[model samples]
Target: MTRQDISELYRGYIDCLNRQAWPELGRFVHQEAQYNGQRIGLSGYREMLENDFRAIPDLRFVIDLLIADPPHIAARLCFDCTPVGELFGLPVNGKRVSFTENVFYEIRDGRIAQVFSVIDKEAVRAQLGNDSP
Candidate 1:
């Protein structure tokens, strides 16, 4: 796929996430998609996403930057979420939190097969008052 094609796929994927369209995300993820150092298969990933959405309630992913090359895409993404329940051990319920993450995607055959990401987890910690916000 050309860079444009891959970029659109990335956009669609994020859009799906923003919409909480769990099934739509599955359509673009490979059987085995690596996430956060774990090889989470499609079903596992879906369940994880559902759990997170249940906690956050209102979650949106914004693409700050997107770059596509053969079989890989680099994205700087901003996630805005409202805490409706407990997450990461914090009961920051009904509050809003915004965080940014950088994720690298390895794609093949128009499907995302792997992802590596890093976020300012410390910032998240602070937001929940576990650290200085």
Candidate 2:
């Protein structure tokens, strides 16, 4: 697929996530997708997202940046929400925080086959009144 097509596909995937469209997720994600270094298939991946939404009711993914290179896509997703309890092992406890997650995805057969994500835990910690290490 062309870069534009891949980027469009990714945007649709993000939209699906934002809408919590679990049934339509298979259109964008491979059934045997892997996240980080773990091979957590589609069901596990969906469960993870569901848990995230449960923890942060206002959770929404805003794309701050997106770059597509054929089979690879790099994205910076911005989040501004309050978690019910803790986030990233920090006691957020409904305190509003803003952070960015840098993520990379590998596409195969027009679907996301793998993902590597890094959240800005330090940013969240500082926002929650913790000292930067």
RMSD after CA superposition, every candidate = 2.0, 1.0
- In candidate 1 the C-alpha lDDT for residue 116 amounts to 89
The whole-model C-alpha lDDT of candidate 1 against the native structure comes to 0.82
Instruction: List candidate 1 segments past 4 Å from native.
Output: none
Clashing residue pairs for model 2: none
Candidate 1 shows a clash count of 1
Q: TM-score per candidate, in order?
A: 0.87, 0.97
lDDT by residue (1-133, candidate 2, tens digit) is 8999999999999999999999998999999999998999889999999999999999999999999999999999999998999888898999999999999999999999999999999999888779856
